[model samples]
Target: MSEPGSSVAAVVVAAGRGIRIGGGMPKQYRRVGGQAVLTRTLDALGGDPVIGRIQVVIAADAAAFFETCRAELSPAVADKLLPPVEGGATRQDSVRAGLEALAAAGAPDVVLVHDAARPFVDSELIARAVAAGRDHGAAVPGVAVADTIKLVEDRDAIGRVRETPARENLRAVQTPQAFAFGLLRAAHRAAAEEGLHAFTDDGALAEWAGHAVVVFAGDLRNRKITQPADLIEADRAFAGPSATGSGAETAKDIAMTTYVTRLGTGFDVHAFTEGDHVWLGGVKIPADRGVLAHSDGDVALHALTDALLGAIADGDIGTHFPPSDEQWRGASSDRFLAHACTLVRARGGRIDHLDITVLAEAPRIGAHREAIRARIAEICAVPLTAVSIKATTTEKLGFVGRAEGLAAQAAATVRLPEDAEADPVDAQAETAMRQG
Candidate 1:
């Protein structure tokens, strides 16, 4: 047992290759919500005032990858991090290595074992796990199972139903599992001596060692990312509106009533010059001639930026970054679109969708359509499905048909809080009520 009011340490297991995710790099190193998965996990742990020290367990060959993840962390969190130790093949072995490393450095009174892939583990859950561990010496977070679970006799192949477990008594376990430092260390050592290394979780191992483990309430949103769909869902959760204070309202209600929708349209044209290639939608295409313009002349992005500004009743691109400015000479058009997105977010608005049509006769847009769509989505920080790009020709009827220049027209749909001042009738009614 730990002494009263002793500090807490944490071990984050991030050494798994994440083969199921199928990303070339490990899933922990993959970008989630503009930051690495490991970075977000560290940030979550660092936010908790109860946790004093943190040790990360990573693969031996992932030193460079871990360093890149560390660089993205804030100074305060980075300072609390101990030098990472190399992990073993199995998760149990990796955790044992981490516990040994912590013991070598003078272990804390309590320790929490967490997964780097579960980035949504909030501070409230951590507090619950810590409190339970302090009381019970060993504790794991778990949520009661909601669905019927069946046990199969021959689990690997076609089998018969052996039994069905009561849903009320069953639980789906999650991390960060907490334990008293000395007790957990001894338990891990005993397991190694007994050659008991195949246990899936520390709670099971603790039970095997004859220690009573308590279960604490776990969060529904605290999901582990094991596949690509999980990553996509995690990203969507980050992008969606938080459900902090919307009492008794569904997500759809909050989304619909919180903002009023507006649409804006923009068109841009650029003449071809005597160079090799032209820029369109932030992608440089191999063309017969470059665009004659003050900037790189990405018609697709320029039109989209203008449409975004128009949606919010802001001025056009010329008003913000005038062609007269020397700094914008040869500047990338992506900056313009990004600035528009920033303004939308600053006003608590979201760009719901962007539709663009490119009118050109040369260079074949069909081959580059998907790339353009993806680039726009990245610039706007929206999903690819929210951005649409199409192309057409005028059948040799105009300058575009003659292959002398290209044109792009875009429409942007955005949602923002309805402006009270813009509705004069409502304002007048409110004024009358106040005066009366």
Candidate 2:
């Protein structure tokens, strides 16, 4: 049993290919609201003061992708990140690999195994999981079944209901499944020894190993991203009124009294080149040809950044990170946008919304639209709903129609405090004259 406030660690599983989502990159690496799903997951876990360390399990071939996501992490969270380990053929295998990595690093008193796709897991949920793990040997978060479930038996494409399970006794399980580190490690090894590797969740594995797994309350917002529709719903859910609550209302009220709103528009274009990929909205899409540019060639991010700069009456992307600068030749466009956001914040301003439209003839944006929107949201540090990304073609009429280049247009809405409107130099000169 773990002592009160025992050291806590987390193992994030993110090795799945995520083919069901139908993108070139793995689903975990895909952006939601401007950040990778895995990055958000890590932020939730690492931001929790209770979690002492974190180990991520990813595909061996995804080292580069993992590093790119890691670069976007907050410094405090990045400090807690351990070197990632490679996963195996199954989820069980992957968990075992993570467990082994933790053990090698000196396992904590408790561990939480989380799904990388579930980015909405909050610190409260993480604390609950940890507390439950301390009390019980193992615990899994779960929610009451909202819909009646049927135990079905399918034969030759025919299905028959065997019986209806009691809804009261049934719970829909979720992760950050917590356990005494030693107990979970031992159970995993026992399952391996017995060749029982088919368990879908660690809770089931613990039960099979004769350990009672307790069910704790789970958050509904912590739904895992699995299909394309899930991404759409998640974007909508995050953007909905419930998510913003009084915060949006308060912002609006403040803007009405002490803030001024500004709007700016920007446009960018990039021609195709002889390469296998293109960067758009900070996501690397597998394309037949890349774009010609000094930076990572993200037309969406570039336009959005320029729009942000325009809203602030600051210079455009060229003025900030000129193409003539060799250091920024291959820089990611996320940095440019982040810098613009920083400038806005420095002026006591906030980005209210960002809308972007992409003109492309190939590499359908439909598949990567949500990811792009999510990426922009993350970069802007705004809600997913505040950002929008749309795609269209010229109908084979011009350059875009001929499949030669892509164009992106963006608009940024911003709010700045009344005090930010004052020029610091003027204010200083006025103060000096008065004193004199």
Candidate 3:
């Protein structure tokens, strides 16, 4: 493949032979779900839209192993991966070798340095890192330390525990640390010239090279798979009974977050156009004229119906109940709102709350607000406190002031829970997958 700019390239460090896991093969080639771990790592990087090409580094003898592993890759990613290059004995040395390959291939504006051990990096983090490199020349994805840390001195004899490090000043670093092509190249070249190889990670190399590295919030989902247990947890995270997982997990991994969506709308027009009495919030208010519409035209009911449907991802009243319906041509609209609430519950979704606002210059909606609220709540199958009916005029504007038509708007929030079951379908899928 033709070489690309540094910005478009990634040096995936897969050289480590994790002895702790005790797998005969290097941990990078260890299988997960019948696929090599490194393959999954590259899958995530290649899946990132911002990334263009990847250069994976492995121990010299591991080239043949990567070849056998390549068969496991999805067709889409197999083409993007460059041939594995031999790595140096140390992690830093392997990184330098990968960088050299990138430079020779026509370095992009920036290069991402990542350990192949982490596979859950998300698109947002990738976009942020690349954006930072474009804007600031170097950036590393990291999260702040939430626990107290301490610094100790002297081991053997007393093994004295020393001072407690200030918690406010600590941050735990993680990878896919990205850097501008020139800056990273310069850091490596400078370190080589000085015979220095002491830095633990590439971002620290930037700091030692007198470059200020920027830190951005990183997703906790991006975890390093240092042991077999980590892989099990990762599997559970991506595909498992996590829907009923703890709130702490929800707070950490936003992808697992579920949101309740709701909506409401209203329409009102005073028939004061040429009549007596008016309809407000399902009630006929004593007035010189009633609301002007083919039907009693309760603007409050229309608004509440729209809100309930919107909350549950259902269609609006206009779609379900067209004015063309001669039966509803002059029929009561309170029934429409009731039907909407039922539709919401039928889908395992519930209307948590609703509010409607009516705009009319007359009929005094203020004093009648409470009575309207109670009536609508009973009609809509919700608590009076959970539903609010309000009225306000635009200070006499448009058709509202001229008393041509009354308009109302409403909003609602609904919560839905999926009906996942232990029935045959779920059981079959689970059993088949476990058997694999």
Write down the TM-score of every candidate: 0.57, 0.59, 0.53
Clash counts for all predictions: 0, 6, 28
Note the Cα lDDT for every prediction shown. 0.82, 0.83, 0.71
Cα shift from native, residue 95, model 1 (Å)? 13
What are the per-residue Cα lDDT tens digits for candidate 1 across 253-287?
Answer: 33322467889899999998898988888888998
lDDT of 1: 0.82
Model 1 misplaced stretches (Cα beyond 4 Å) = 1-122, 130-139, 144-149, 154-160, 164-169, 175-215, 219-259, 324-326, 346-350, 395-402, 417-436
Alpha-carbon error at 1 in model 2, in Å?
17
Model 2 residue 368 distance off true place after TM-score fit, in angstroms: 26
Q: Distance (Å) between predicted and true CA of 218, model 2?
A: 1.0
- Poorest lDDT segment (10 consecutive residues) of candidate 2: 245-254
- In candidate 3, how many Å is residue 144 off? 1.7
Off by over 4 Å in 3: 1-6, 155-158, 238-436
Worst 10 residues of 3 by lDDT: 239-248
Model 2: per-residue Cα lDDT over 353-396, one tens digit each? 89999999987888888888777766765657788888999989
Per-residue lDDT for 93 in model 3? 81
